[model samples]
Target: MKLLLTSGGIRNASIHKALLDLLGKPIEECAALCIPTAGYGHPMGSPEGAWRFVTGRRSICPMVELGWKSVGLLELTALPSIGAARWEPWVRGADALLVNGGDALYLAHWMRESGLAALLPSLEHTVWVGLSAGSMVMAPMVGEAFIETRPPITGEDRALGIVDFSIFPHLDHPGFDENTMACAEKWATEIGGLAYAIDDQTAIQVVDGEVQVISEGNWRCFAG
Candidate 1:
């Protein structure tokens, strides 16, 4: 699978280019699936938030609003009861999966329950375009600091571990006081592994087992 992990969605031309490169095609020619499950897991995520993302109404995170050939919603919570036979094909057929932001653990929990985590290794041709928590869910772990949703719903900060490093997204955003460089450094210290602190204009791309940073704003890497 091709990964374009971003702090925000394609906020600049470079990230958009990176996304196009991952898709190997234009946005207008590709089919996409909008996964808004992550939002439901956090206070930041609400029905209005999910609605904005699915309908392409968001201003900052422009996942669904990117003008794809076609866009469909793939809520992870619903996949469990529907059976794999009905939903697996939809995943296999999409060119890219546009995952939303909110809570990584909540998203990770659903990914496991919905069987999407196990199925991810098989989607070799697909592109995963993630926003904030959407991207964090791909990392090894988000650390306790990022764990907003807790307990029986999701007990750990650990995610899929598909990627070798952790991510501190939304760095230096005016809206989030805790998303500063100092906070990221503290988070990185807890992670004790390779991690990237990226602002909204930055992105971490992984393809063919190689990771690359693509940015138009600010970013830094902390090595273990």
Candidate 2:
């Protein structure tokens, strides 16, 4: 599957262009599904937060309001009871998945439990547009510093490992003073693996196993 892992969604023209390139079509032609499962796991996550994400009221970027052909909700927590045969078709038919920010490990749990993780290997044509924790979930680990809620199955810091690195999102954002470059450096050292620290205007794109950093703002890569 194609990945567009973002710190704060498409905050700049470059990131938006990268997303378009991944979509391989105009936004109006693509069908998208917004996933809000991650938000529910976070301490700050609320019903209002999930609603904002689904309605694009958070204003991180176009996201759910991207003028797609259609936008649908994909609540991972509800999938287990519904059966894969019913929801699998919805995922396969969508051109992209817009995942929201929250607890990465929590998202990882549901992805596995809901059968999405197992199905990821076959979603070669689908693009995953991830915001914050959504992006972090693709990493091998998000590091202990980012853990809000410890996922029951995976280790405290470990994640989905779909990508070969870790991510420190919201780098240097004024609203999040803790997301400083120094903090990211500490996280990199603890991670002890390939990782990236990205600000709101940056994103990491991975397609066909090739990784590229797309940014209009600050970013840094730390090698293992």
How would you encode candidate 2's per-residue C-alpha lDDT over 22-106 as one tens digit per residue? 9999999999999999999899999999999998887755588778999999999999999999999999999999999999999
Off by over 4 Å in 1: 151-154
For residues 48-78, write the lDDT of model 1, one tens digit per residue. Answer: 9889999999978888888899999999999
Against the reference, the lDDT scores of all candidates come to: 0.93, 0.92
- How many clashes in each structure? 0, 0
What are the models' TM-scores?
A: 0.97, 0.98
Worst 10 residues of 2 by lDDT: 150-159
